[model samples]
Target: MRRSLPVDAAPPVAVGRGEAYENMRCDVCGSGERDEELLLCDGCDRGRHIFCLRPIAARVPTGPWFCPACAPRSKPVKRFPMTQTKIIDFFRIQKGAEDVEAEKCGIFQDVKKRRKRPLVMHKKRRRILPYVPTEDKVQRLKQMASLATAMTSATMKFSNELTYMPGMAGRSSNQARLEEGGMQILPKEDKETIELCRTMQKRGECPPLLVVFDSREGFTVQADADIKDMTFIAEYTGDVDFLENRVNDDCDSIMTLLLTEDPSKRLVICPDKRGNISRFINGINNHTLDGKKKQNIKCVRYDIDGESHVLLVACRDIACGEKLYYDYNGYEHEYPTHHFI
Candidate 1:
């Protein structure tokens, strides 16, 4: 009295050195039916339904078929630790690598013709500068297009700065709310560095950065050039919304913007609809012993122009090709990062 499901014709088996059918069950659907429809990953040795793939492979792959999670990725992030005193100094904008001599920093050895003046920030609005790729025009266009495509998966539009959404306090009107939450105003040097990044965009320059897709970590940012410690990496930007409104929000990347005495008045940054490169950064695993060691970037919140703004700053010197990572839940530990590497 039961009808059987129609099975597609058996396709050619792939030549892979994976484990011989441990359970022969589809890891995605937990189905044992149609043994021909399952393909074991060469790396993880897990079976996946052919139809469960994004592109839906017609037949078994030629050599290896690694699942999305098991694919080999390159994002060798540094494991530098920032001391508590240094973090307090960062909040106050006390000292930075901009004060050191670039030539003597030993980051780039080819800086013999540069001037000795310290990098000074200007007074301007915060913005995300366009990344100028050190490649030909065609390649630049390709990289830009690739970046756009990578971020557009969630229907996100490229934004250089934060967008004020409805139900959120106006930017300039949030001073009292932020102050009520023990938030301090952004210091002058830190404020100017933000403008410097925005100004650099106007001059067709940017902080040397690159975005790469990793299997285990998803999309991650890497330094395109040698960078000094305490450099402003980028701002964690998106639509600003009140915490009370987004309590049940399904967004996974929402960052806490402001925490107030009243739990209902807190603000969170949601980068789902619009965002910048900061949206792609991965978080550190604070639950493990090696967690703090993997974070090279620091996520700090400051009241900029009476509005809560989050900035990612480098805690130590970063070499080119090194991936960037920060603590999602710093000392407060709001979010869970046990699953993260």
Candidate 2:
């Protein structure tokens, strides 16, 4: 059923501004036109009027356009070279099957008897049954259910720091602080904040702790010390061209952070491949096992004097030692498995 067009017998003519135009009649309609409006075929030098072509045009095309005579013809494609014996054997098998089916139907006898009833070929009916779960599949489901129960219990135990208070339905303390500060918060410490604080604490010279990393809960940014929201967590800096080349080559496993939504921009942070402690921050699924909603942080675009930055902002109050998590896909329920590290 497959067919292929033959390769062009003639080489394509290079079309450029300085090519010489030949004076000739329209090969399609056999009409001659001396006007500059006619388009000359790059292959045969045949002239064609703007209106005479199948697709009537208003102007010359940007690229080379060939005439019908100059267009390549299609040739029947043979995938494999066939022997004469193989061809004869194929036809013989087909003819034999047809003859046997015809004889079994007895079309000649029905016509001789002057029967007018249409011939009907009754086909055997087949019933399809629903798939029954295997014993292994059922056992797997039970194991998954048990795992979900355990994870739910563990999550609740670790999340006790986020105590619920009346009248604060959804707003966290950090969110309230952010609202009071006009959505922008000044960084209290520079890039060496965590390292300096750790070093100072080791020398018994530091203020109350602001954040800590728990083995089970990852890094938790606390709001106990009037810490402002929209804090600069950490950043991954790399060559924009190198990141683009990696993505172009389908090496997207490292693309963990989306710095910009605009394609024209070239700012993508890939912390999964190389990053600081912030990369250890986990992401929440659409729904937890306990059926409670849980997104704590958000990635926001922050511009600093013409340079772009992606900042992690606390959308709700995060308690001390509470795990930090954000929706990786921006939307709930839609999980992109391939993009996950």
Candidate 3:
């Protein structure tokens, strides 16, 4: 017979064998080892049901395995609560009303001193025109002259005065003679244009002229005369035949006047061939370091005598000799600067 085992020679306690001694329940499913197959965590000896494993191991892991909580690689995320003092410091709340009152008083004193000084109007500065290559300038001038000639020819051919006489199917004899002779009697001056011109003459200034110059991006409009903000820059008046035919997203150079919200009532104005100084007003895209916009003008639609007109209104005080700009995309903040020049 074998000798009796010594008291210290008894086997060490078997981990997760029975609930009587180990009393181990799965951390995941709360099932004891006697009720189901369990994996005892090698690190903390916590029980986890075999079926409750996230990936459901086919068999016990070859080596020692840990329960989800006791895994060496698992980390618990810690979050700290925001305190009232932290918020106050972030917002820089003032602690004293006396400091604020003193600051206000200083501002008031500065304003009073400024009011006592003699009022002096700021002199308008001169805008430096961009230099263009001689060849490019000549080509552009030739193109402009050609376009003007074509426009003049078309105006003479379809003279507005040459209308059908009473009980006649064709133009009046005098109109026919004027057309056949190729004589273009200048149409009566537009009252609006004439009145604006007179106003400029009274101010000892001539009407502003459009000058195209090569800039960093491309050719752009520059005014020869200083134009005041909110003043009538120029008027674009023409027959419906002169408007653009195609309406689409690709056409940014054209301004479409929405007579009504309905698409059928929309009027598209294309100033590509003919327009006033307003056409030269570029869209605002460049911004200051703080994202402040430099746009000083806006396009407003006006209805006069059953016709639609686009007027450039001064949105803010524009300095003289500054480049004119407006929000072309309507929404100033959401404009796609990449699409603009």
lDDT of each: 0.62, 0.36, 0.41
Which residue pairs clash in candidate 1? Answer: 79-293
lDDT of 1 by residue, 40-133 (tens): 6767667777666553443344444577788776345432123434322222222343432331233223222223546569664442222223
RMSD (Å) per prediction: 14.8, 32.7, 32.1
Better of 1 and 3 by TM-score: 1
True-vs-predicted CA distance for residue 334, candidate 2, Å: 7.8
List candidate 1 stretches off by more than 4 Å.
1-143, 167-173
Over 1-341, each residue of candidate 2 has an lDDT whose tens digit, in order, gives 00111233354454762243443556566666534547676676667765565534433454456666786763422222234344223222122334433432453354346446565688732211111111242332332232223323222111101122342212122121222122333232222332332332222221222233333332333322322344333332222232343443322223222232333333344332223323444555444443125556675543232333344555654554445566655522333322121
Quote the lDDT for 185 in model 1.
Answer: 74
Q: Show pairs that collide, candidate 3.
A: none
Listed in order, each prediction's TM-score against the native is 0.60, 0.30, 0.36
> What TM-score does model 3 achieve against the real structure?
0.36
For model 1, where is the 10-residue window of minimal lDDT?
1-10
